[model samples]
Target: METVEFYNGNKMPVVGLGTFRVENNDDCKEAVKHAIINGYRSIDTAMIYDNESKVGEGIAEGLAEAGIARNELFITSKLWLADYGRENVQAAYETSLKKLGLDYLDLYLMHWPGLDEAVMIDTWQGMEDLYKDDKVKNIGVSNFTVSHLEALLAQVSIKPVINQVEFHPYLVQDELRRYLEVQNIVAESWSPLMNAQILDDEVVKAVAEEVGKTPAQVIIRWNIENNVVVIPKSITPSRIDENLDVFNFSLTTAQIEKLNALNEDKRIGPNPDEFSGQ
Candidate 1:
């Protein structure tokens, strides 16, 4: 797997295994453990998922089972909206660290942009404090649009190193990607392969046929080819194994253009900008 560098000089894998809606504490742990044993080093989790502790336990189990060292893995966690203030942000991170059973996180992100200026400022401060303390290797945001990022940029001293968002063929965020590239922020993808809208699209099947891979793999390879870090989630072993098969093939430029044309600014997930007051 390839790696991307954060402004702080942290190395993160280009592809990661996502743990979203990973139900049943034991089951979630097992998936994570198996994913690691299968060759995944980057794992994404969030405090709001209420599975941090389980994920930590799974990681511990996987490390012991596979003899993978702690430093060899890249662990990421997020601060929830309830913990948006300065004090609460720090407190939340401490709790997350405890749940994750780690001394420091590879990446710590704001789960969502605050509803107002006060909360946003407080959250930024909390992140800044963590960055200053060297507890979070990389500080970033999720579900942030260009305007949302600009708002935070005006007040915060340290710019976010990354922005995790819903990115896939049907929801290509061209404008956002360009803006982030200009800002030198790596764009991390979520819900990258779970786009229900495109699962039945003829283009997906066509691309899948040409590559002799699933529509999911085609979309994921599209992500990797476009320089986006993909975090695809799956609980089944075969599906997990299938998702990692992107490393063996490359998409041609024409095929990429065809996939890019599938975007209609349609999002399979919620647009926080409208409801979150971004």
Candidate 2:
């Protein structure tokens, strides 16, 4: 799998396994192990996902089974809203580190903007401190809008290395993508498969047929071609293998244009502006 060059100079895999709904220890551990054995180099998890411990165990198992070094994998976790305060941020991050059983994290992020601008700044200071201390190699944000990023960037000494949000062909975030590119922050796609809705779309189907691949592969390839890191979550072994099969093909310019034309600005996640920073 290919990797993206992050602001911290670390290489993050372009494709990863997103353990969003892998709740139980058994399922989460096995799914992650299977993913690594099948050639995944990155695994994204968060406190909100509630499976960090299991994920850590799976990493251990995969490492022992595959005999890969620790630094060869890129692991990312996010700080939850409850831990957004200055006092709580550092402690919460430590807890996450302990749970993940890692010497250092590849990336750590503010899951959402804190309730107050001051706290957001404070929490980011803690993140900056962690980065300096070598606890985490990179610091970033998730679900942040352009204004939100601008707000934090204006106050903080260190800019975020990445901003992860919902991105797919139908929910193309052109303006935000352009802004982030200008800022030199990479955009990570949380739901790059369009919730499987586009798997049956006529345009995607046509593209899939032309490429001799499934619609999901077409979409994943599109995301990578767009320079966006993608993590498509699936517990099923077959689906997981299918999702990572995107590296074999490339999307055409006109086909990419057709996919771009399918944009409807749809978002499955909630709007951040109306969030009141909570």
Candidate 3:
């Protein structure tokens, strides 16, 4: 698998498995196991998803069966909105670590910017503490816009190493991507396929057909081509395998431009600025 290096010299797999709505413990466990068995080196989960234990179970099982060691896998989880303070954040990570059955995380992210500036600042402090304490290998944020990042960077002693956000052909987030690039922070795409909406786009479909690849493959390739990490969720074994099959083909410059032209600022998830949590 291709990899991206964090500013702190940690390596992350360029592609990973995302566990979002696989709410069932058994299913999430199986999905993680199957994904790892199929050659995925990275796994992405979050506290809000409520399946870290199952993901951990699957990781253990997959590693055992695949004959891979613990350090060979990259695992990630996020701090939820409710855990947005220095006091709550550390405990929240501990809860996820216990649930995931791990000593340390490869990456931990602030799940959303939410509505509290002070709380978010405190959360970053917690993240910095976690990193400094060797509880997590790298730290990042999700759904953070340029404004949010600027605010965080202003007060942070350790800059975020990644920004996982809802990015796809329809919501390219060009300016934010540029900012992250200039700062040497990697951009990770959570909804790289836009909840499968891009599968129906004429441009995506045409490119997929021309390359003899699935629309999902085309989209994933587009993300990789743009130098971004992507975690596409799939519970089905075949789709999980298909998502990682992009390494076999490459998208031409014109085809990539065609897909880039599909940006409409559409988003299938909630806006980070307005989300205040339930």
RMSD of each: 1.7, 1.4, 0.8
The C-alpha local distance difference test score for the whole of candidate 1 amounts to 0.86
- Candidate 2 versus truth, CA RMSD in Å, comes to 1.4
Mind giving the per-residue lDDT tens digits that candidate 1 earns over 1-278? 68888777777998888988886478899888988898888999999888899899889998999897998999999988877888887889999999988888989999887567678777889999999998788899999989888888888899999999999887899999999999989999999875445667799889889989888888888998988999998878887778887888888999999999988888877787654622
Model 1, residue 163: distance off in Å is 0.2
Question: Residue 145 of model 2: what lDDT?
Answer: 88
Across 41-160, the per-residue lDDT of candidate 3 in tens digits comes to 999999988899999999999999999999999999999998888878789999999999999899999999888888898889999999899878899999899999999999989999
C-alpha lDDT (0 to 100) for residue 26 of candidate 2: 81
* Better by lDDT, candidate 3 or 1: 3
TM for every model, in the order presented, reads 0.96, 0.96, 0.98
Q: Is candidate 1 or candidate 3 better by TM-score?
A: 3
- How does model 2 score by TM-score? 0.96
Error of 2 at 236 (Å): 1.0
What Cα-based lDDT does every candidate model obtain? 0.86, 0.87, 0.92
Which candidate wins on lDDT? Answer: 3
